[model samples]
Target: MTLYKIDEVASECNLTKRTIRYYEEIGLLSPQRSEGNTRLYTREDIERLKKIISARDVLGFSLQELHRYIEVVEMLTGQRERYRSITDLEERRRQLEEIDDTLGKQLDMMESKMRTIQSFKEEAEQLRQQVREGMERLGRQSVERAEAEH
Candidate 1:
């Protein structure tokens, strides 16, 4: 198993060392520790950090929301792993239902954020249209004034 120190992980993940530490502090990450108490990260840890960054920067998730999102994702991951081992049809069906429910929660969060972003985009478009109209009105008034002077 390959392990990396914090600096390597931070550089690879495009995050600062402090940010990685903060993520660990906030329960967003849990890297292993070395014999001297230094943080050691695995490839999985780097992937998780990337997910966190995407949720934060792309999805505009608040820390609280990100936490919940990560929780659901982790739960779903575990459920998927457990699903492969079970042979009972009823148990597999139940596991599938749980996975579906977990997926629904993630979808809900994304849909809520999308709705908020869509509203903001609409407001911006409205403002842009208003400004365009105002500019055209002013241009017409200036033209009329010039024509009167001529």
Candidate 2:
């Protein structure tokens, strides 16, 4: 197995050495050690780090949640590799379907909210125009009356 120094791994992943070490300390990664106590990372380790960071920052998962997902992925990988479990595949498919459904619902809700806001803005604009017209009419009437009285 080819070993990568901390700098090499950081450069490959576009993250700082401190961040990588912190992730390892926090149980997010488990890079192997060489004979000289150097950290050696496999391709799988890099992929896992990518997943962890993306899940936390992009998908808004907490560290604990991301850790759980990493464990799940690891377990699924093992099961698929060793046992070739069809049930695990089916479960993953179901989970993805549920995620799609939830995302669709959220999109619908956001669209509804946007429509409501647009309607309110239109109504407010119409009311403001009416108020302006009413004021102008009242001012003209008052001026004519004053002139006639004078």
Evaluated with TM-score, which candidate comes out highest?
Answer: 1
Residue 148: error of model 1 in Å? 0.8
Tens digit of per-residue lDDT, candidate 2, span 84-115: 33458777676556556555654554466567
Off by over 4 Å in 2: 83-150
* C-alpha positional error of residue 88 in candidate 1 after TM-score superposition, expressed in Å: 1.1
How big is the RMSD of model 1?
Answer: 0.8
Model 2 accuracy (lDDT, Cα): 0.76
Candidate 1 residue lDDT tens string, 75-130: 98999999999999999999999999989999999999999999999999999999
User: Using Cα atoms with residue i matched to residue i, what is each candidate's TM-score against the true structure?
Assistant: 0.97, 0.54
lDDT of 2 at 130: 100
lDDT top scorer: 1
Residue pairs in steric clash, candidate 1? none
Q: Candidate 2's error at 146, in angstroms?
A: 22
